[model samples]
Target: MTTYSEEMEKLGQVTIFDLLPPSPSNAFSIGDSVRVVITVESDSESYHYLEAYHPIVLKKRGEIIEIQGNQQYLVNFAGELHVMKEHEISF
Candidate 1:
């Protein structure tokens, strides 16, 4: 019989994102116009677990300025730049 440690070792490290389906926003490219879909707190407990986009970015529209890989994007909201994830934005 396999021990709990052995099973955990086999599973390795997994995050919630890994268990969820890929976001359609994953296909977003530079120059795409997108809008922030969710508000995240910079001081939340889950802040470390996910990207923390400022509340100001919530419901704001921006253009994708760069693709940071791993589904992260650098967006230009007016003159300000913020890094966001695919799930945080919509077309």
Candidate 2:
């Protein structure tokens, strides 16, 4: 079986958070309560592979755990963790 590190290597650097500074306009800070505002849908028949926040997390309440620069945020919903864009969530 492929190790997690190897799989990550194959995918290259998925993010460059360390290379960039925190967004000056970040609306929310760590420990802030928020909710996901977007729902994702996929259409396999159209040959389009669209992916975003899961449907289960839509409108669900979560807390900001980390700031990922460029308006991205790491939120904890219950015990589950998900990365969300600034526009995808609201206070």
lDDT of each: 0.73, 0.72
What are the clashing pairs of model 1?
Answer: none
User: Candidate 1 regions off by >4 Å?
Assistant: 1-25, 39-56
Q: How close is candidate 2 to the true structure, as a TM-score?
A: 0.55
lDDT accuracy of residue 59 in candidate 2: 39
Off by over 4 Å in 2: 1-23, 39-56
Candidate 2 positional error at 83, Å: 0.5
Best by TM-score: 2
C-alpha displacement of 34 in model 1, angstroms?
Answer: 0.3
> Candidate 2's residue-wise lDDT over 1-91, tens digit each?
9988668867884547546766578889999999765543422422122124344465368999999966899999877788888877899
What are the TM-scores, per candidate, against the unseen true structure? Answer: 0.53, 0.55
Task: Please report the TM-score between candidate 1 and the true structure.
Answer: 0.53
